[model samples]
Target chain A: MSRMILLTEGMSNPEEAKTATGLLRYRGEEVAAVFDSACIGETAQDVFGVGGAIPFVDSLDGLEADTLVMGIATAGGELPGAWRDIIADALRSGMKILNGLHTFISDDPEFASLAAEHGGELIDVRRPPAGLVVSSNEARNTPCFRVHTVGHDCGVGKMLTALELTTAVRGRGHTAEFLATGQTGIMITGSGIPIDAVVSDFVAGAAEQLVLENRDKEFLFIEGQGSLVHPLYSGVTLSLLHGCAPQAMVMGYDPTRTTIRHSAKPMPPIAEVIGLYEAMANVMAPSRVVAVAANTASLQESAARELLVSLGESLGLPATDVVRFGCEPIVDAVLEERRRVGEGAED
Target chain B: MSRMILLTEGMSNPEEAKTATGLLRYRGEEVAAVFDSACIGETAQDVFGVGGAIPFVDSLDGLEADTLVMGIATAGGELPGAWRDIIADALRSGMKILNGLHTFISDDPEFASLAAEHGGELIDVRRPPAGLVVSSNEARNTPCFRVHTVGHDCGVGKMLTALELTTAVRGRGHTAEFLATGQTGIMITGSGIPIDAVVSDFVAGAAEQLVLENRDKEFLFIEGQGSLVHPLYSGVTLSLLHGCAPQAMVMGYDPTRTTIRHSAKPMPPIAEVIGLYEAMANVMAPSRVVAVAANTASLQESAARELLVSLGESLGLPATDVVRFGCEPIVDAVLEERRRVGEGAED
Candidate 1:
């Protein structure tokens, strides 16, 4: 793994620093520093207390990391204009660029040659693969227990939950793989189709490729995209759901969000959201929501526990704050579901 | 309108024959003939009894239609392997192919040159636009009433409703344009993005461009695909919703089924589905479900009326089968919503 510095600029909070924030949560060991001018004197823990103390710096000068990852994830994943010079500076310093934004740095001939000269690579994580067709339902042939992490809304830790669940399952000596469907997740995993970048029709087909590609894994943990309940992004969510043909799913959401993030639509009841997901899954693939993974960024410890308990009671599924609780419940739920499937197959 | 032939071979009933059947109902004037070998010698009246007399032929020999539109829309939209020779024959016979299938005919060099020789077009209706970015929220600026036709499930008259509503609204002296988001819709309108073909991230961005491009229209009738309740296709549904930032919406559904079509998953109540659409729309553009357009194909004339009446009473919105009752209620509702908005603006 290449040592990298996350460039969040002056953005405040985990929400604005989504790409960087997600990396810090899951790939902190690879991160050498976070260059956010706003929190110059602070560390990752000072801003987001859940992730451990990784140093934060205000300037790019004298940073020893060999790669710089664009840390901001805007609604459209477009690179901020302010970051153009920063990227150029990093290239001059011989640091590879890993960008999860829709705007591809490699698409620029100037930047392409610059990175080439420095022996540094510029990876655009959201580039759609060449020649993707619609799915042929081949994912149905996979025997592994597929667990897709769905969310109640966008930016609700679906990717993080999926990543954590993979690690957690593997810790128990099970081979699990993380299948990413978005730019940020693809950046970390180094493998995944940016489903959103693919034409709408082939989103599921691209997903099938991901599953088929990782068929050898004992468990496949596919990261989810926008929520089926999210008005603007439910299409991607549905396609991914159908594509993965997951036997089980984990529901992820920000517990404090009464409404969809960045919009005023009050979230439907959690029960109703699950009903929608299960209702669709029941048609395409016989899947169940095995657990609820809450993003407890806004909640205190007791508040998060109360929310999880209520979710567990009302939804009758294992519920945990993936960030705060380390995604154990989700992993256990996947294992339980797998065992049930195995026993059913035997019968 | 370009005269075309419908091709629904190896299919049973009108439901399985969605694309061909839908075109017969709505774009009857453009349909020269339909070619379904299984239902040879049967006219549209003989097959469905809705559309007027259109010739049905079993063979491609001496076919006279100027365009051969792929009339069979299967899930994932892959071209049937058996139909490959039929397409090749049509190209040689000098008929342009309007292929909505995910497999593009232009991708084949032989077919591409064949079409070029005949001055015929190989329109891959689902081809995603190159270099699509995520939405920049430009749709928030459109002043005309923007309405998205959302559905209870896929293939439930979302496109047909949007098309009919556009015709209906225009008849009432409002300029309404149907924004197509799929291959079928794109074929009819000669314009549209095929939102499903779009990469997941840019689904909304493509939609915003649609809204932004048609800003001058008095009423923008945006076609929707797949249900927000659909597990496989909801992401595109949500992106279109947010991307358009519609001020009003029309809910589309097939009133016949107790379950999601083809799957065992029970359909959510119409009222709850409407609430879900409204809930999400409320956050983005403060849109309401102005009406419901039900696909009453499975019901008799009397049965359709009964269902619509009960639906209107319970959901408290104007409801009608666009194909059966002619979409008057939906058009009236949209006009009424526009009136309400104008009144509020004046106040």
Candidate 2:
């Protein structure tokens, strides 16, 4: 049997970690104890509830374990000195250790050195592929698109988006699948991981799934959470397109929460957002980039036009190549035209 | 100027949309009106604030827009009949509409038919690929691995994990990059998109980026978010592995939450949380799946071993295939061993 200590700078999201514990057990692992420097008053049992791992207040009580897994700290970086000492003490005790910090691996050097010296290894898990071979076998004749929806906790907009996208793409003479990825309520409350990473990873994962599942489809559609405000969400999508070389990629354009005032900036500028879209189009070199401002009023026509133009220019596409459809009539007209094209090609 | 109705089911997290509106304005889009159905007693001005786009109740009185973009609904399903009436009225009035309700399109066959009859197309935006891809020209002699960290909103556990993974992988004769993903906040109170999507997508995206940017790498390493009960999160990652098909995948095994509570009477046995992981491993079939579960204590050894064996069997792999390590020392050892192997191969 192995035992380990999880040292953290502050109170961790015990709920999520608790969930992870169940997963670990399902995979055949045990958690001995969790020690948090920030959570002083509460016992680990109290914090995590029954069947939860125990909590340790002090690091030096001759706690023995075959291994120790470190809890992640906040954005400011590393646990306080006391916590570091505990980690060092654990290392000296001949306990094996694993660190699960992804960003800090690249951003901090001191911690990196310490990890090396302590005979502990820090593993960053999000590195890219050795190689990717994308074939259109799965996507042939399928209407491929991505849908993004926004919502708060428990809201079903994201799910709705998945359902809708699947229906629409299927309707368009193609097969569609719902690839689910996005932030959960815990993440938004600031407990588990960063928003940017959430968006990026989801987008990429969705794309990869689409490419693998619908290899012969002519288009790729993505659906995402609407409320998050990370540039990387859209950026990562573009990067995927470049790698997989999808014939075309479509993204839902809904910016609902950007208007609010918050400590952290709400959303990126529309131009910036559009810029990312354009950048993706450029990288993927799609045949045409379509901008469907769905249900946006004529009042927003100017803004939509500007975004379309910018997107076109960034992609070095002509205005004709960047199609803008607004209102039901326009949306219908575009779809009709597409249907007609499909029909004509069949003829 | 175009007039559009922005219908929100309830309180919308107006973070990203607001910023995007400013950006839209910079890009020259006029936002006409925003209708929030949830603001029962609040005045339109109070809810919408003073801006180009005024907020109103869900009424279609003398409103006109070329397009309509539906915001996230606090309610999980289709808009109420009254709300739907307003939207239908707008559509009847010839206003173009764009909505994020991907589910509504299918949930309501009438709406789907109407879109088809009216020539409106429901578009789904597809996300780009996950992970980083570097060109062969940019390849370096050193190998690189990706690190992922998990934390609370303010915690930097992910950052640290990233840092540590990078250090260890690089030390093992490979270069390392760090990526972050996942949400960091309180447990969101609803059922919607799984939260793990955020982290999984980010990891995938980061990996895609690396691969596209540097094409010479032969493998991708992903560090996953450490959680316990939510199979959805872990499931999302497992799904992503199938989609991404990385050379190897490494994950931490800290089970505090993955267990199914057995009840005497008949509700379905709470599905094992690790079932998702097992399913994902089977589907992805990565070359290597290294799981570090060196955290359980002696008292819990039996349970831990049972869980591990079950997990291994589910994935159709041997128990020995899952690597068990103590936290610091084990991580160090793994990194060192990997590095030596890489160096040996290079030599």
- Highest DockQ: give the candidate number: 1
CAPRI quality of model 1: acceptable
Global local distance difference test of model 1: 0.80
Among all candidates shown, the one with the greatest TM-score? 1
Residues B228-306, candidate 2, lDDT per residue (tens digit)?
1221122233323333333333334334323311111111111232332332233222234333332232225677678
Scoring only the A-chain of each prediction against the true A-chain gives TM-scores of 0.93, 0.40
lDDT of 2 by residue, A1-347 (tens): 55555554454553234222322222123555666656666655465433344654555465656666555423212334555566566655555645443343433475455656766554332222322222222222334432233222112133333344455556656655444332221211112222233333233333454455644444334333322223123223332333233333333343343432211334454444444444323322332333333212222668756755664466443221111342332223334445545553321
Alpha-carbon shift of residue B136 in model 2 (angstroms): 35
DockQ of each: 0.37, 0.04
- Residue A179 in model 1: shift from native, Å? 3.6
User: What is the i-RMS of every prediction?
Assistant: 3.5, 15.3
lDDT of 1 at A269: 80
